[model samples]
Target: MNTENRGAAQPPEPARGAGPGPAGAAPLVDPLAAVRAERDPAVDVYLTGTVFLDIIFTGLDSAPVRGTESWARGMGSSPGGVANMATALARLGLRTSLAAAFGDDHYGEYCWDALAQGEGIDLTPSRTVPGWHSPVTVSMAYEGERTMVSHGHEPPPGTAPPTPRCPPRTRAAVAALTPGEPAAWIAQAARLGTRIFADTGWDDTGRWDLAALPDLRYCEAFLPNAEEAMRYTGTDCPRAAAHALAERVPMAVVTLGADGAYAVDGGTGEAAEVPAIEVAALDPTGAGDVFVAGFVTGTLAGWPLADRLAFAGLTAALSVQEFGGSLSAPGWTEIAAWWRHVQRYDDQNPAALRRYAFLDGLLPGAGARSWPLRRAVPTIGFGRGT
Candidate 1:
């Protein structure tokens, strides 16, 4: 088995009674006591999947010619997959943790450092294998489109180690997986009594065994994009595909890029098409992952299916308006404000609204011509609008 250590250094403790203590008393306590006390029992949203370093190069008009190069307007490293989802959840004030594998290399260290600084993220379970290099994806974004080349190592053999000690308040977990690892992880997650949300990764190609579907039978929700749903169900129509999945799983959701998403309640035979949030596309890199994050967050917050889809769609729409994947994602407060202002506009005011509401009649409580209004908002250094 590949082995590598990529753990982040623990933060330094403050001096005794340096600030305020319980009742402002200079109470004596063990240094590790605070760390132990901070162990949140809240069911952490477990993001089990791949974490990659995204190297994005922008500023091309179309696909590059062989040996030809284009200047990159911007470039940076950001989290990918489960790491990105966990980051989004933490940003939304959910206590989250990541359970995944990274190579024992600088990239792995980078991932550890990046995630360690985020609020509500616990990264104790990330394993580093010695012979593997952390996955990396390099993409070029031009004219709002992107083409990418990725390299990911195979997972080491052996089951993941048991979870670290957690506070009793853990609430939910979302696990993203390729077909190779789905059955075992899904069964394990279901047995834990944790609300399990899952999405298909790139490995769910035609070769995947349909028998594995039974393993996911107990999942609270199963998410797959249009292409994945089509491949999995052997159908091009998303609604039909969703129905096929619902026949096996409890709930199935198929996200249609630019068209919105289709969800079905297996028990009630109820389905709804949540309209996509209209926004000018920049680079549609991590929009789907962001959508999953939004949906899971909404689920944990007890939101109805309609609102859940709305949150998911809105978050995805916003993600493409910027360059990086999770870097482009908006926080809960930002999304809430955007949704209230952009989606809830006055339908009667022709001059005030933007166009692109093709699903007005198709979705419930929707109006015609719902376009996003772009205003010059001040950007903080951290991608937040002030």
Candidate 2:
């Protein structure tokens, strides 16, 4: 296992010489430009978690057979785990800072460079541990689902440079709440006036008690899937679950897979829902992370609850059409292209198009990159040069 430490220094300027680094990369148009404040937070979003090197195999007809050799038609690899959400936020033009550990091995070096240089994420708070091998997850995707097997051990105790006691003061932070294991930094960041948006993984313990998550009180919004919201709230319907959850947090967003998402604002008793966009899904790896990033962007820009839901759903829908987790995240260029493409379809429902008509004023001028921007190569190790 790798150990991580935080530093007070700011992110270094992007390196100059590189085949595809942050240097000279055109900045995406900021969706929040109109709301820019003279005293804006130094960072738009801040998050800390484990980073995993994800190896994904796609284009499989079904789950692997027990006694036979199975082959996948396609494969891709990239930084994953918390990196998924970090990359998603960065791609959407949010100033994202990530605090995590990286192994000293080749995989770790590749992952670090990919995030810091390629994605332009701030890593001053991150550290590298000597002799630690990067954790890895082998994922198989088929039928819009995925099965993953991961392996890694925690860093032995007494390692140099422990986790940071205080995180940077950012506009917002995303926390993954786990039962019985509270993150101390969540409360600290909250006290510093950072809006907290949180999500949860499946509770394998079968105990969905809301009491287990003591840090929920500090959060401004809580996003959980349909099943998770229903289980935690003991509600028969997802919309009801959202309402129940809203009583705990100011806002509750419930994601219903193909049906899209529903959200409720307890502060104002506002409710909104958006249908999912139809597209051929190549991989559903980082769609959830993308969804949260979109919502955060809209929220920080002061968008309405309904528009937030719609934008979140639209971003997730676009991510499923690609492969990998972090690399599959779409940028503003992709969003602009999709908006233009849909506008050409005159037969489409006017209401549906009007729902997203707001993008017309927010989108940047046409960029040089083509639609469906070509993503990074499936695997690392093409020599660090290019």
In order of appearance, the predictions have TM-scores of: 0.74, 0.93
lDDT of 2 by residue, 97-206 (tens): 88877888888888888888787788887888878888999989999899999998664564433456557768899999998888888888888889999999998889
- lDDT (10s digit) by residue, model 1, range 22-51: 211222211122223354444346666678
Model 1 segments beyond 4 Å from truth? 1-41, 102-105, 128-132, 152-169, 180-183, 202-209, 340-386
Report per-prediction Cα RMSD to one decimal.
9.8, 3.1
Where is model 1 poorest over a 10-residue stretch in terms of lDDT? 15-24
Q: What's the true lDDT of residue 223 in model 1?
A: 95
Clashing pairs in 2: none
Residue 108, model 1: lDDT of 70
**lDDT, each prediction:** 0.62, 0.83
